[model samples]
Target: MDQLLAQLPPSVVALLDKWDSNVLLITIASFLAWLVWKVIYNRLEILTQKTRFHWDDLILASVSAPISALIWCWPATISLGFILEDYTQSKLDWLSTLKLMLVIGIFVWITMRLVTNIEDYALTQKNRDETTVQAVAKVARLFFIVIGALTIMQSFGLSLSGLLTFGGVGGLIVGLAAKDLLSNFFGGLMIYFDRPFKVGDWVRSPDREIEGTVERIGWRMTIIRTFDKRPLYVPNSVFSSIVVENPSRMLNRRIYETIGVRYDDSQQVSLIVEDIRSMLESHPDIDAKQTLIVNFNGFGPSSLNIMVYTFTKTVNWVRYHKVKQDVLLKIMQIIDNREAQIAFPTQTIKLDLENAGEFAGMQPQTEHQQ
Candidate 1:
């Protein structure tokens, strides 16, 4: 390589000397980085497909670029060292500082990748909730970021004592300015511990009139995907303030109905009520252990009212509806077999000939008829 450069023209040789070491090192580093990245990344991708454990693949994917850069940093620093000795003192100092910063950047990048992958791993655990996992991961990331910043500052020979003192005062101002943000942050923490609802659980807030499946629990907001598929970003603080109903926790679904029989068929009310009660008790879908009430509740103006109160074994909305429908159909069949009728609101008024004279006397007489 040296002989090849020697054979070149004098001007070309001078130009070559200007860029020789740095250029050669960088080219070699880039080639090696590419080769390593391709080989390792492809192998990991194959392994990821073959195995159930995916965290390795995720970590590799996330850190690949940073690892390549870190590899290049070695050659870069060596190249920069050659320039430092030959260049102006100021330029040498700047390059040295830049190289240090580059090293710190790579460290921070790798740390972030590791933290993210760990968080993702936590999410895969059957016992862990998505909201809690996310919160922990975010806190870990923030911690690393703060540490990285402080490390970079310390590398630059900056005093943290003064910064810490200033931060104490500044933090107070920042806390006051971002009170709502702080409140939400703490609210999210409370949710993590309290666990009122989790991701994928259906929840509704009676006060806010919001009902949806929890999509994600973020640091400041909890994302809910409504039944209509609209994304609702609710502040974590709002959850702490309101009553949230998590229907997903229900063991059974309720079915309460009022069926009125016609006054004329009131004689069969006792038999009808007993049959209905027996049907509910023997039904496959109705929960036998739960409350099952069937009785002649009251008499309305036009009918005798029977109240049927029961619970379905299944808590699933669709299945509960199907069970309720089946029960209602069976009830209708029972009523029809007994020669009974379901009643609707109706009214009756009787007029007598003895009362006709008063209405006739109240009518105004026409002039031509008179």
Candidate 2:
């Protein structure tokens, strides 16, 4: 730059000499940095967005502004160093400290933005579940953060030997600092070992309001998709404290119901029960071996209540419902064969004999006639 300026006319050189060389350098660098920042943020960013790769776009979008700021400050830092060399060592001692702090701080800031970008991008992807994506991203981010920190420290004249000597105490400090994270990590390990549930399992917890299909299980959390199609993010630590019921692993789906017949059909109760038992015994869908029970449980006010307790051969939710419908329709056909009608809710009102004359039009039976 000095040589280039020396070739200029004497008038221009005199004009330029009015300002200190370092200050002039900084001024020129600042203007150049601004132009570069505009091209990067406006032009290059647009170009990156057009690419098919997500990493390319994310890297540019997340780190561009910080990098531009770093560029602007770099020239000033160099000028400051040059000026500090002429001053007393004690007076300019903070320069190295400032550079050290600035570099580390910028790195941390840039890394955080990068991690956040990755997380957001991962969620929009359909190929992987949220739990798995976040798990991999977090682990990678942490690894890079540690490595970057050490690199920055080394660059700032800090020795790795001094850090290694604090290993025992550092471990304790890290454990204490990340107590909840470690708890979740170990909880994830327990899930893998104990195998309470796996991906695609329909799990519900009596302890927590967690009921969903396990989409994916990460190191720190699990992703569940509820019946209503909402995504649920639960920490792995929660599994350790909660009781999860896995219905997907069940051998059969239960079909338990109570059917009633009008009192008029009391004579057909025994026949109906026998027919139902016979039908269940021969039914292909019903598991007759699994403690099947079809009997007249008791008498109700308006009808004889019969209990139907049995399991289906299949555990599939949709198929189980279809099987249940078939069984119920068959029972209806049996009742029709015996000329019995299913009873509905009914009530009786008894009025005083003398007062009954005043309310003569009122029916004694509420839901059904006797």
Candidate 3:
């Protein structure tokens, strides 16, 4: 083997000289690393299928690319020393800094992957909504990226004290410049922790005349999709400023209506009122636990008003509407069966000839008198 190497071309001999046993060692190490990764991945895949905790599989999948990159890059980086032996120490130091930076980058990548996996797992557990989980994950990723950047800077022999001082001053300036933005960000954090309303929750801000389903909660704003299907982007600060009504949180929806009966049906009004109350009490959808009131409120200009105040067992809009319609229809049927009539706005005017002396004087004489 030595004689054959010597018989090679001069350039080839020099190249072989630079490429020493370390190259072979690096290749073997890289292969072993790859093999280990493959074995672990396959085992995790099988385990995930059998285990209840499937998040482990997700985590493995997320880190697979980064692990592969690290495995290959580590070996190549080790071989760089043998290849660049004739290079200056300063150039080699740069390479070392680059390698450190790559290591920090890989750490950040892994951290981000873990954050994503954790977010996904939390979502499946229903502990938080999609928007909230994503926001939290992004915040975590930002934290890891900042730490990774600081680590890379430190690896390059950069002082963090000066950088921290600069950052402090710069942060203050940015805070002052973007006061509203900062307020919104903190407001979003408040919403996240307080959980006033989540995605898909029906919310209405009476002060702002905003009523919609929460689609997403971002760093600075919350997106609402209105009933008309228009997208509304409201700042998080606005939510803090306004009164937000989350109707989705209500256990039951309310139904308050006034039914009018004609004055002629006054005798049957009491019976009608009692029957209506009975109907509400017996209705399956009506929430019996809530205050249910049926009373003869007062006499209106056109009719006698009967007040029906009750709550349904459902908070769903469509279901509530259906219940309300059915109740109203049943009330109408009861009134019809009792031979009663609903009142309408009407007016009556009368003319008395005896009281119209001025009009009588202006009228023409009868034919016989003429």
Winning candidate number (TM-score):
3
Model 2 whole-model lDDT (C-alpha atoms): 0.84
Local accuracy of candidate 1 as per-residue lDDT tens digits, 242-268 = 999999999999999999999999889
Question: Cα-based RMSD of the predictions, in order?
Answer: 5.0, 10.2, 4.2
Local distance difference test values of all predictions, in order: 0.86, 0.84, 0.87
- State which candidate, 1 or 2, has the greater TM-score: 1
**Top model number, lDDT:** 3
How do the candidates rank by lDDT, highest first? 3, 1, 2
Q: Tell me which of candidates 1 and 3 scores higher on TM-score.
A: 3
Candidate 2: 10-residue stretch with minimal lDDT: 361-370
Pairs of residues at least 3 apart in sequence or in different chains that clash in candidate 1:
none
lDDT of 3: 0.87
lDDT of each residue in 271-298, candidate 3, tens digit only: 9999999999999999888999999999
Candidate 2 residue-wise lDDT, 273-368, digit = tens: 999999999999988889899999998988799999999999999999999999999999999999999998898898699877656655555424
| Candidate 3, poorest ten consecutive residues by summed lDDT | 85-94
Residue pairs clashing, model 3: none
